[model samples]
Target: MPGRGAGRVLCVSEFVRNVRLWFAPQEIREEGGTPDYRFSLANERTFLAWLRTALALIGGGFAVDQFLPDLRWAWRAGLALALLAAGVLCALRAVNHWVRTERAMRRGEDLPVSRFPALLSLVVAVVAVAMVVVVLTGWEG
Candidate 1:
């Protein structure tokens, strides 16, 4: 708290150091319970992984819909809309999932996984495949 810092708050680094001091033991135990940093980081990584997946889906969908020569207007629109929805859903789920995971980890328990991601991914995949089919079929009618 020295230097030229008048009221610089404790950033993550400071907070982490303080947490380390407060729970100095190799394993944090609280009245017959243990706090797990590994679990917290694992959950964080999972959320990050999901977000990355969402971004990739968005990028892939847009690239195909906008830049691909074979994409018809209808197909492109459908794919783009689906991808956009998926991306928004992913962002919403990421925050909620992270909070749920953090809460569970803090209490040293497991929470039920939501099935919405799998269901949404399935719907998105179907839309993507449909787009590809439409592009390939070349409007037989």
Candidate 2:
């Protein structure tokens, strides 16, 4: 029997256990770590959601970046940049939200509801509406 493999397996198992334990603080607060874990997972999900939205925006930008036949390449490129910028901004916000939520959880304080993300969402909504208007009226010129 090749028992050397067992030693490697044990080492791997120990490493994973150590890392998982280290993932969260071990101070053993009254609230435990579940809430923190929840907030962390929520943050991760939010990031994924933002990534999906970014993909949609980039795809739309490419699809409609140059609707008119005579539109300049610079115009299309600028739209692409705007879409990418929106994605980057969204990512930054998701990280910021996670950090604040995690900090609150650590301090055993009431988690604060954030308005910044809601405001950003509204901004995106308005931009979407404006984009529709521009696309619809693009042929007028």
Candidate 3:
């Protein structure tokens, strides 16, 4: 029974260590070198900003789905779903971008470029135009 208890404790300890490693602050991978703390902080800030954008998009989707009036069921559903999906996609991309940037910094490589800003702008523009048309034409169902 004592051996069994010790084994259980060891398993739990290993699990906790794995969790810590998964969520720990970014580590320097380069031998005997670390990236500038300021740059790392900036990267973290950018990641947080992207997360905030994702949250806003999700909230907007909920608002459209629950509050918007004078829209057909299909229109509302489509727009809301698109927004929510985009939000989730943005969040996933943010994590990838953060990791890539951090790694590039550690390796002294050029940071990867992203076209998401342009794509997001285009999507928002298209949605805005559609909303305007629907409102101006009084196309309520």
* Cα lDDT for residue 103, candidate 2: 53
TM-score of predicted structure 1: 0.66
User: Residue 25, candidate 1: how far off, in angstroms?
Assistant: 24
Candidate 2, 68-100: lDDT as tens digits:
344445555665567667767666555555555
Better of 1 and 2 by lDDT: 1
Off by over 4 Å in 3: 1-32
Give me the overall lDDT of model 2.
Answer: 0.61
Quantify all predictions' global Cα lDDT against the true fold: 0.67, 0.61, 0.79
> Candidate 1 — which residues are off by over 4 angstroms?
1-34, 139-141
Better of 2 and 3 by TM-score: 3
Clashes of 3: 0
TM-score list, all predictions: 0.66, 0.55, 0.74
Best candidate, lDDT-wise?
A: 3
Error of 1 at 137 (Å): 2.5
Best by TM-score: 3
Candidate 3 least-lDDT 10 residues = 24-33
The alpha-carbon deviation from the true structure for residue 98 of candidate 3, after best TM-score superposition, in angstroms, is 0.5
